[model samples]
Target chain A: MMLISAIILIIMIVILPLETGRFLERFDKGHQNDTGMVFLSGFLLQLVLFFPVALGTMFFIRQDNFVWCTRIYLILSCIPAIAGAVCRIRKLKEKKPAAGPERKAEVYKNTGEEKNGKFRDAEKTILWAAFFIILAYQLYKAVTTAFIDGDNTFYVTQSLIAQQQGVMFTNLPYTGGPTSLDMRHALAVLPLWFAYLAKVSGIHATVLCKTVMPLFLIPFTYLVFFEIAKRLYPEEKNNIPFFLCLVAVFEMFGSVSIYTSERFFLTRTWQGKAMLGSVVIPVIILALLMIAADIRDKSNANIKTAWYLIVSAGIFSGICTSLGVAFSALLTLGGCLVIAIRDRKPKLFAMSMLACIPQAVYMVLYVILK
Target chain B: MISRLWAYLELNIETVKNYAGTGFLLLIYAAAFAYLLISEKDKAKRVIFVWIPGLTLLFFFLPPVRWMYMKYIDGSATYYRVLWLIPVAMTIAHGFTRICEGFKLIGLPVAVALIALCGGDVYHSVAGPLVIASKAQNEYHIPQEVIETADIIMANEQGHRVKAVMPLDFTSYIRQYDTDLYLAYGRELIMRPDAYDELYSMLCEDPIDVEKMREAAIPRQVSYYVFPKTSGFVKDPESCGLEKAGETKDHVIYRDPEELEYMSGISYYYFTD
Candidate 1:
């Protein structure tokens, strides 16, 4: 049963979301983007779409019928997953013309040039080794650190409540009563969602929370950072991976004088706040850079694409942590304003405002509910 | 205090020392930044490099912003500081290529030193802590015992609607057996508390008030007292109408009223007035 659940989880969360993202990427229409990043961008979208649906379902379900509610929630979520898979298949078939193989070859030839200094096979091997090793080391750190301390209890207990009781924002697990969670708890509905996923996936919530997320999200985080790097240094695209390896290696290089990202990323990357700080915030910054690039290049379509991603990122941030929506709005606005003022793009300022709508809406609704 | 800022400077340096093996990676990071500021001319890139860290540092220093944050925000200064993390690392990584180009002769040495520094950090921050945490049976570093004890309490409860009154730390939210079995003294900002302070006061009342303890606890719906292995506060609950129901390595579960509460009395004072 657990194995079956794990397979279902992978299909629903990992595979389906990624495929949906790929299908969504086709909507970029003529934009020249890779299959991988397009698939990844789906994750942010999945979070955006999944948060509302899952929370809405949890909101109305009978409080005691946790198993039934959870089973129903999983079935409802599969609708999108299946739809995405079908859409991606249809999209792929549409893209594949009668002479598709020849066109694919032509496209490969067009994109074949090694932009960064061409690395030898050994150099590539070394870089890959470094990436994997660093991921493993951080995994070790996260898995080993005791989750019994600090706010971990809050996170773990909430996930357990979700898994065992099928409760979300209702049965106040820590205190155990029927009070709607406070403003802080109300905003943090992701762990409950995760608990739902863990139950359906058959993976233990602890393993899913501690090991799986850091192992996957950290590298995915590196991808986001690499995107940021590429934006800043467009000419040095090839060097991004090696630099990312350094990021992996220097996992503990935070200054003790002040709190740094490593403290959370290494220790609490599984928690929502850490995800907010490490992944969501950085992705927002990346979207800002993408929007800036699009504006500078005068590409309206790419600018629209950038906006979609930023708003999706905003929604994810809002769902991930209590302070995430506020931080995202402030940070996205602040970043856009500074960049716009520098580039003299007043219109970019309006677009940046548009980016905050998802978070703003999420924030206002939660406040109203409270 | 102004001195306090500089005082943490040394602590920060120690953070580098312990985490980064005396901050060689940091020195490389500094070198990369200094090299870029000197040689690189892209203003946008320079701003991107400093953007997150610069804003975070400003937020850290600005008293008015801190005041506003404390007023509006509900998180910790230490944690929110996580905002600056990847930006700092990315900046270091971003500037590294420039640093390599700027300092061509010793670039390999810099790379070699960085890899070594990564190893040291992994040892101290990752591997070493994990080793210590694994060995932490008594739980100076990890509280696996406390966690297991929670499971024991839950298993013993067997889905019965029971609440345990114990030391705040023992009966915390972390000590969970099941949804039905709740601890009386939960951690902060809990929902629907069941009058813990009054019951705690009764447990510690002079000369060990037995009838009152039973009346206040079990009647109020608190069914158990999760005492520690060491007899400190409620040394002998036998005199107070609590019999040992279960025992774990770290805790002793004592059921109140010995058996089913025939009367259990009206807990009117336990709730309203």
Candidate 2:
């Protein structure tokens, strides 16, 4: 099943870029001006890059050998992609023509006019108030619940055991089956890393580590909302940053409440922190969409950014939960197809297939391992 | 009547405290909408219309109003009784905003009143389920003996790899130990009287077909036997090889080398029989 999926994914990726290129050519010829084409082109590009990695891992790793190899492949693929994309984006920015004097004057004028607005001041006050209120509440709940719950202790102890064993799968007393430990879930890494740091810092770190997890969601929530706000209202960019901050506050509080109210729902000792990791998948997908939007805008034509987003999304998807990565990729592809159909851009539609190649590869690897 | 009202109020207060942040955000949104309406700024009104309703609905879904309602509502709180207001509140909020934006408005105090009414409806819906769950947890503390035995096993065990017999679904306890423990009778199989009778007959019948019984009883390897206080064999010790290992106020633990021998000896008996 995985092999077939991988092959289909690879085919989609290889074909998508060609389609996107065709769409761009058409657009240049004044055949398409719609934002839909841009979305399709970016989506296809994401598929092509992601599916191959998923497929490769699926084919190469046997079920017994899959978990660690999948994790390794995901991390290896993601880091370089993120680094490469960042470099390419930086290079692209440097190469762009500096804003003309007229554009700079306009930017200054807009900034000055915005500063004089009453609503802006009110919005800022609201945003800050919400942020602090949510942060303080989440922190309080996390602290109060940490000691009372045994699940955190179990996770910390198991993580320590995994670290000592050198491989995540071996010498772990808790896991009964032969499945790979490293492949368990990405959230496991955070507590394990905290355990390692505590060993170095000479402080009892388990409770601190568990307590800090919901707090991390505060920043993660902000990033996701920021990305969404940017995508939804790019021209009204000044308002987006503030709006994102408000959304972040709301999400942070919601997450904290859910965590405290039903601790069992969010984290199984074996699963580590499923909620935080799951939320990250959507955030990463949104970030990829933002990069696609940036590429389409001709603001910076960074192929590296495209590659980075695809690879990082693949790795994060692999690490978090196989299902989560699969769902996010599916959503992105679906979103892309909608854009393509709406815009009548065949090339962009094709590129969306290409962009999802790494995810396909990861899925393939996951199946073989399973 | 007063007590019932107090119970309802207590539930609402807890729900509000639990979801304080969401309430705070709704208040901000309400304030923002009020400002947009009063100022008569057409652009701001347009933006508020586009964003606020969707945002409110999204918040309602995420903190999950339905789940909250289910948690708090007693048997008395029917769906028909409360569900009518969901759309009504939504429509009222929508209409009030439109009217306020037009400045042919029903005054500032009325707008505030409308927002409060709408917010109150949402709050009531969410409070229904929170009360129910809170009451259930308060009422259903696990039996003390069960909890004590579980604690002892948890403390002594290294991981969920310990084997022991339990009267109920003890996987949750085994999970705490991080061990794979097998029940003497299969957890689900024991639930059926016919299955348990067949299993008991096989284990206790004279000139006991130990081989057949072992096959029936031990799906996984047998590590320990937990004989409840009520078991006839445990009450009259002469009928079985199992010797008392320990006893608690509600239950007793038994260990028998012959039982292990019986299980291990069954493989040989299988071919001979």
Candidate 3:
């Protein structure tokens, strides 16, 4: 399963860039509007990059097929390099600039924005300060909790033990039970990846893994918010970008601390799975919202970005605990529906309903499979 | 009134000293609010921001604050007497605000502080003397010895299985290693017995009678007996069969030969018999 996933990932990386380039060329020549195509192409590329790996992991685990899984995983692991190559190739292909006089005029017309650099610098400073402040705060919480309370000890210990046993999945050491007790159900996907890294590197994986989510989440959420802000106030004069970034950082810090602290008392154990879910669920929801807003803003709504968001949301929802998934799916569906109703766009409503299909299918399949 | 105000101030000071994280967070909130007020182009937004500091000041009057106040002012305080809800409530309020605003500014810092504070307690509970108390029986390795003795008797006996009356939670060790032992008496056998009555009966339950033994099946089967070595057991030996099998630093194991011989192949043992 892993091997299959790897191969699929590689194929996606190779194909997606070419597809995106084609879409962009069509848009530039007035064959398609730029707004919807850009979002659709980006969303499609991301889905193509990530979905196969996630699906392959799930399929292999559920079916208990390790052989093909190993092969698929190796192939998937090459995707980043493959993607880089594809990007370079596309860049080279685009190097022969169009020779039309209209193109030169368009290029010259777009270059008159030198005066905004000072404002951009000020905004950049505020953004960086806020980012660092939040990062420092998050680090302090993670470190103090781990040092004084040792929340990550169990995960670290389990990962170390698994590494020693030379297995990706194994029984937790303290359970002292039969061979039937597998702990894969307790650990999540990202933690498993981190544990694999730990096994290879011979270092504690929990802190690094825990740290990676926030780092990725902060930036990803920032991008989503930036897109939303850009659409909501197209004038670009408002400090929406700064505010959005500020909110993203704050939301991450607050959510992490609350989720961490709640789990600390409730389970009295430090497991990264719960924390990962809390962080991922909110970010994914926000991302989906932004995607919906983007699609709505476009002249010809990108059915593809809407589809990708729906599918990604469904997949993420499926991975989380039942109640969490339910809440998130409901929120995304409701939020999108509300926006569609308020905007009175049948296309938006249709897109939202289409997006919801993946989750409904996921829920039915989940029940059947379980 | 003056004394009360002094008491409140002293409490906040002590809270600052003990939980410096919270203090630092409060300072950040204060600074942010001050900044908001100074930089306010909007009158209503500035007023709203001012409430942030005011709310923090109000948090200083809660029970934990009162306890801290008493501790600092009069040097009298009990651990559990301190109100723990104030910080938790404030943190929750802040979290809600963050959620509403779709921004995390104040909520995140406050949460970090609270996690740091509560995490300290969790760590102390797990690794400190409380851990020692929880594992007193295991540390002395009484359960292992009991299981070994039971295994010896089971090898020699001809019965289906041995019946052993033991404590509840500690029996996991024997069950882990051995497959055919039955628990005749345990916490689950009697639900919420009076302290003295339960103690007296638990101490007295005999391990010899096959009819009296609780049957536990194989594969999922558990063997061996475990009981706490508290004071009441010594006062009532007939019920408990307080005979010394062996001694460890923390507990003593006890067994009765009559019970062992009944199922000649069956044996009963205890880590602290």
**Candidate closest to the true structure, highest lDDT:** 1
lDDT of each: 0.60, 0.39, 0.39
On TM-score, the leading prediction is 1
Best by DockQ: 1
Question: Is 1 or 3 the stronger prediction by DockQ?
Answer: 1
Once superposed on the true structure, which residue ranges of model 3 sit more than 4 Å away at CA?
A1-71, A77-84, A93-120, A140-190, A199-234, A237-241, A252-298, A301-303, A322-324, B1-273
Where does model 1 exceed 4 Å of error? A30-33, A54-76, A91-119, A229-238, A255-258, A295-301, A366-370, B1-34, B42-44, B51-63, B73-86, B101-144, B172-177, B189-216, B232-236, B257-273
Candidate 1 lDDT over residue span B60-104, tens digit each? 445455445556654354334424532656666666656564342
Interface RMSD of each: 7.0, 13.2, 14.7
Native contact recovery (fnat) for each candidate is 0.15, 0.02, 0.00
User: Chain A TM-score, candidate 3?
Assistant: 0.60
Of 1 and 3, the candidate ahead on lDDT is: 1
Off by over 4 Å in 2: A1-126, A139-219, A230-281, A301-303, A339-346, A363-370, B1-151, B154-161, B167-169, B180-220, B225-273
- Candidate 3 local Cα displacement, residue B232, angstroms: 17
lDDT of each residue in B1-273, candidate 2, tens digit only: 656556655554454445433454345445555544455333322222323333333433432333444563223322121211111222233344334432322233454443444333211122233411111111111234544554554444432334455554332223232223333443234334555545544444544443454455455445445545555431254234445555667777554445442221100101011
The candidate 1 chain B region of ten consecutive residues with least summed lDDT is B264-273
